[model samples]
Target: MKTEAQFENADVNMARRSFLHYAGAGMAALSVLSAASCKKDHSKPQMTTGIDIGATGDLAILNYAYALEQLEAAFYINVAAHMYTGASDDEIALLTDIRDHEVAHREFFKAALGTHAIQALTPNFSSINFSSRASVLGAAKAFEDTGVSAYNGAGYLLKSADYLLLAGKIVSVEARHASYIRDLISPSSFADSTVIDSNGMDKPQSIAQVLAIANGYLTTKVSAINYGYKAY
Candidate 1:
């Protein structure tokens, strides 16, 4: 008994609902596509240059220190993120504090470098298994000790009093961290034969030497040219 006009009106209403449903679904699909697109971007840290820091001597030494700090910072940050096995509460707390210190060191170098600062470095941690406590603590000890040695070795290379003082401050804290990790691993590894030289001074490595050992763990080669560090 309904009029044809009313029947037509109902058909039009159904068509509008169908259209809206399809429109909403299309919008949702578009949203997902947009998010996926964003995830594909791999843009990273950029490099800047032309600020003369001198012929890679003092500036180069600073750059070397900066690079090492970056490596240490990244490693500790990773350790904190995916903590290793058998990590005690105290160890975790202390290591986390060290991680914060490394980050500060990296940032300080970056700020001091100004326009000559190297780009953000990505660490290769594949050599050390993060899931195992032995691997993590072992790597931590190596890093901390190496950091201490690097500072001591490079201290003589730094012409600027400002830089030398900074290195001393950072390495002292690094040594403390190293000792703590050593004791945790074994009772007397801190001042043991592995780290301390016969003269009782910390064993040190030159910039070239340290880079050779540490650079293997990096995916990208770091250039010290801009910072006044000569490769040879």
Candidate 2:
């Protein structure tokens, strides 16, 4: 019953599974590294006032990303603090993990931007009823989806290869979060036409478009002064 072809197929399948497992572990390790490296940077001067996350440069893009991460981290932190009623244990664990990932992402951008990073923003979650699962999950879906699209749209604006690579790594994680949240809201809607286009690509949003949606939940205004930079 053990044919050579069957054995080869089994080996190939095992290899694929192993590769996926290792890749997931690698991303997890990266997240830990990002968070652990967020030590006190006493040497770098902090901005007392919030700066416009704009200008034609990589820093502007990084700050844009940082702003989004701050919003997401704050949202998840609040969700974790006030767990919605009727939330299952699995839901709690997933939300906690998402919160950790967002914190790591926020820290990574802050560390990378150093003194240039914008001030910590105050979120206006007045519209979100955190006590209700529908409200919480709906907000989660919107944030995750918006984040993934923001990164995708902004990736072309990055001139530095390093920044692009870092963005790529983070965007993939965001997309995964979006997919998971989408499925949670409605099973089997993870990769539906709503997010994925006819060309089989995730939809992208301009900075203005994203900020318009994000500002509804943020008390502090985020502006992109001069983001029309030529790609390097």
Best by TM-score: 2
Clashes of each: 4, 0
- Report residue 44 deviation for candidate 2 (angstroms): 23
List the global CA lDDT of all models.
0.68, 0.77
lDDT of 2 by residue, 93-116 (tens): 988788767877776666556666
Instruction: Pick the lDDT winner.
Output: 2
Candidate 1: C-alpha RMSD after superposition = 20.4
TM-score per model over all chains: 0.72, 0.77
**Model 1 lDDT tens row, 1-232:** 4443453354334434444332333234334533553566534423523222233445556667777888887787777777887888998898878876776666666655555565676679899998898899889887888888888877997755655666787789899989998998898888987878899988887665666666766776565444434333
Model 1 — TM-score against the truth?
Answer: 0.72
